[model samples]
Target chain A: MAAAREFGVPLTLVGDRERVEAELARHDCTGLDIELWHASEVVGMHDSASDAVRKKKDSSIRVAFELVKGGEAAAVVSAGNSGATMAAGMFVLKRMRGIDRPAIAQLLPTLTGSTLVLDVGGNVDCKPDHLVQFAVMGEVYARFVMGLQSPRVGILSNGEEASKGNELTRETSVLLREKPLNYIGYVEGRDVFNGSVDVVVCDGFVGNVVLKLSEGLAETVGKMLKAEIKSSLLSQIGYLLCRKAFNNFRKTVDYAEYGGAPLLGINGVGMICHGGSNPKAIKNAIRFAYDYALKGVNSRMAEKLDESFPKSVREREANEAPADAKERVVS
Target chain B: MAAAREFGVPLTLVGDRERVEAELARHDCTGLDIELWHASEVVGMHDSASDAVRKKKDSSIRVAFELVKGGEAAAVVSAGNSGATMAAGMFVLKRMRGIDRPAIAQLLPTLTGSTLVLDVGGNVDCKPDHLVQFAVMGEVYARFVMGLQSPRVGILSNGEEASKGNELTRETSVLLREKPLNYIGYVEGRDVFNGSVDVVVCDGFVGNVVLKLSEGLAETVGKMLKAEIKSSLLSQIGYLLCRKAFNNFRKTVDYAEYGGAPLLGINGVGMICHGGSNPKAIKNAIRFAYDYALKGVNSRMAEKLDESFPKSVREREANEAPADAKERVVS
Candidate 1:
């Protein structure tokens, strides 16, 4: 809603009528092209993503996605159950043609601008081809959405060496080498924050753990700092003096600053926000949804997939064969 | 060397004769009952662990581990190549009886206190049995060394649900439930820093990544704070005032404070230090090694394994059966 007001974009709020109205009344939302669409239910955070989407047919998440599917809304943004959002997206928008699996792409704040990490709780046991598709989509998102001319893509592994990861990573590395993206072999976990690559791809299991661990660790560090500062009068005074610098530091690591992650490879634009997202995060998620739709990232992903894997019989043959023995060259 | 001097214990310094003498001279180790044992070779940081151990038979790491195996030293500690250290450990000390794989356990600083996370880059592809052993060893270390009674053990996964992780985690969770330790089931990555459990067990691949990623992010956050503070004159003054608090915060999160991770499941005590460990970190590592030897952690682990997996034919039969259909009840 804040994004709509700030960007002067038309927005439709889908949720319980009374609750939505109460929230709107609490804020000055006047003169903004905003409409409230009523939904009878909500998917709780602890609820199973697929089960909730299946049961709550008239859920706010479902209703919002319906609006996008019906051409009433260009995109849907939700700071709710992530699994439900992904389930609703797959159920409503469906996967793009030729895309085997969809991935969640999250932008991690780095010393340099940011690095896009994919499969952040989207697919758990990803195959070699699934990771290849993520690389292609991630590259497109990096170039078209993040505005990079050539994005360096890397498979997240235990070590930077090609032979350093588990079976999935080793297989994915072989496949990524065949793609058109600037595949940079493998990157260790430290490289995720070091900004060594634009896109770091991994199975959803590892990516999800990495994402949540980073959030938890950052919060832990902040809390530890506060506790130490308050332990002594001298440090307390020091903390007060450096309050501005600390606040600036907090902003740098704040999840709100990066907004929500985009559910890539879905047919339509869907932004999945952290469940603990504040108003600013919600606003940024909406902005991302709007920008993703405006940029036609999904369409571009489809094009990139087509370009990388032509529909010719030879292309299918190449995919069927072992990655190292591919006859046709990838463009 | 500092720990040996401070603790009034005799110390044997292993490395090149000239380098050891120079280091001792630089550190003012005048009358500390320290003897320098010369080794012709040193394992490079990037050297393959197993290959280096095989080739550099007279390397410092190899000689140090040999001392423990030969009863000349009660324990061995090295602030050198981790891979080489593990290799030297396995080659010299060998795995404990009934232990399938050795693991590295590191103490992670949490909000409340600290959480011990195991298999941090020891065995990359771990079996369910390996994780079960890690749980037992970790629990013992937490109790005997860290002074925690009945430490809660949890498996690190993407979700809290038993069915949420990959095949390895699911299988490991089942095995852990049958163990005598305080098994708390599946814990997500966030729980690692939340201090929700005393021991978080994971495959070495995931554990290593989490360890490195945390270190990298903590450093990144520190760097970002420094940069933000120096961006303006006012913030710099605030930083000076808060410098004491920040230093305390750094000490709290410092890897040196926790010393080094123990190489569990080995027949002898071996502590692995960070490659860039300073004199303080090395001193702490030596202290930990001495304490581990005094506590007889390895002997206790052997006894625990014997009790957990009895040598009776019935116990062997139970181990052979599927996890769900085990005949004999776990003690």
Candidate 2:
């Protein structure tokens, strides 16, 4: 609400009536044009996203998605359960044409700039085609949205060697080589922080672990540094003197600086913020969603998919033939 | 050699004779009982370990393992290529009676003490039984070497929920529960740094990535802090005052302080250190290898495996029946 009010973006708030009213009463919004939409139910952060989407017909998340699907809003930004947001987006807006699976593109802060890692916590088990699609989508995101000319794409692996990864990564590397993108072969986890590449692609399992592990490590390091600095009077003086630089460093490493992760390959613009997002994070997320909608990322993704995946689509269709027949028989 | 000399252990140096003699001459070894063994070939850091073991018939690594296998040495410690060390250990000493795979147990420095993560870079791809065996081996190391009474064991995954994780983690979690160890369910990547568990188990691919990424991130963080401190006059003064504290912090997180990773599940005690290990690191590696051998960790691991995996071994044997039949048919 603060973000919309400050940015002068016409905003519609959706939630339980009393809670929304109570929250509105807490904030000053005298001249801002705002509308409140009542949602009969609220989805808890730990609730199963798919189950909530299916069971709670009038949930705030579902209603928010409905507003977007009805063309009432250009985008939807959620700081609630990430899984629910992805589930709702998939259920309401669906995947773009030729996209096998949707992915979450997380912008990791690097030494130079930021590296975009895809499928951070979306699809756990991914196939070679899915990874190739992720590379194309991540490339388009880096080029069109993140403003890179030709993003260097890399498949996350155990080693930098072409033959170093497991079956998934090895197979994906072969398929990635067939694409027109700036493929950098295989990159290890260290490459993510060193700004070695613009985009890193992997199955959601590895990506999610890497993302969370980085967060945990950064936090732990900060805590340890603070404790060490406070242990002595001399260090305390030093910390006071270097506090500004430390603050700048914190900003660079902080996830709040990136706002939120964009849910890519979905038909509409949706941004999923951390569940513990502050007002600033939410504001930034709203800004990202607005920019994403303005840039028509989804349409460009569709075009890129058509251009890059003609062979893959055909092969996937051939592979699905028997499964489709089995489905038909079951139906 | 320095450690052996200091500890008064009879040391047999296996490498190119001239180089070993030169190194020995460089260090004062007048009273140290030392013997030099000649190895015609040396394995390069990047060479495939298994291939190097096969082709480099008289390599230093192979010869060192042979000494241990021939009961000429209590243990073998190498600060060279880890893959070569593991390969040599497997080829020369082979696996323990019922153990299917050996794992590299890496001790990760944490805020409160440290956590032991197994399979840091041993088997890139692992199965449920492999992970269960890793837990048994890791638990024994933590108990006997690290001296934890009953170590908390966790299977690294994306979430803490029972249902959270990929197929491998889910299966491993089930197998872990069947063991007699302190199974802590699924732990995320963040949990490893948070010191949430005593032993963290995962496939080599993820574990290797996590370990390297942490090293890279720690180095980057230190560099970034130094750059920030030098950016301004106040920070420069502050850094001087806090230099002691910063050094202490660095020591706490330093990989060198942890010595080296032990090769567990092998029939003999073997250690693999970082290729860039200094004399101090090499000394620590030798110390760890000595302790590991003295404690008879391999024999204890065999006993633990028998106690924890009665059902798993039976099931695995049954599962392997078909493969054995296929091999017989082909033969």
- The prediction achieving the highest lDDT against the true structure is 2
Model 1, residue A74: C-alpha shift (Å): 1.2
User: lDDT tens string, model 1, B1-331?
Assistant: 5675686556777889997777667777677667777889989887888755788999998998777666677677777888788888878877766667788899999988899999996477688888888898898899889899899999888888765898888888887788788899988888899989999999888897899889889989988888877887877776677678788788889999877888887777778888788878878877777777776666676677777766532343222111111111000
RMSD of 2: 7.2
The root-mean-square deviation over C-alpha atoms between each candidate and the true structure, in angstroms, is 7.4, 7.2
Candidate fnat values, all = 0.73, 0.71
Please give, for residues A1-331, the per-residue lDDT of candidate 2 as tens digits: 6665676666778888898889789988898767788989878978898765798889888888777777777777788888888888788877766677889989988778899999896588789989998999999999988899989999888888876899889889888888889999999888888988999999998988888889989989998888999999999998999999999898888788788998887777778889898878878887777777777777677778878977655654322110101100000
Supply DockQ values for each candidate.
0.60, 0.63
Model 1 Cα shift for residue B198 (angstroms): 1.2
Pairs with steric clashes in candidate 2: none
B125-235, model 2: which lDDT tens digit per residue?
A: 788889988888999999998899999999988888886898899888877887899998999889888888999999998988888888878877777777788899999
Clash total of candidate 1: 1
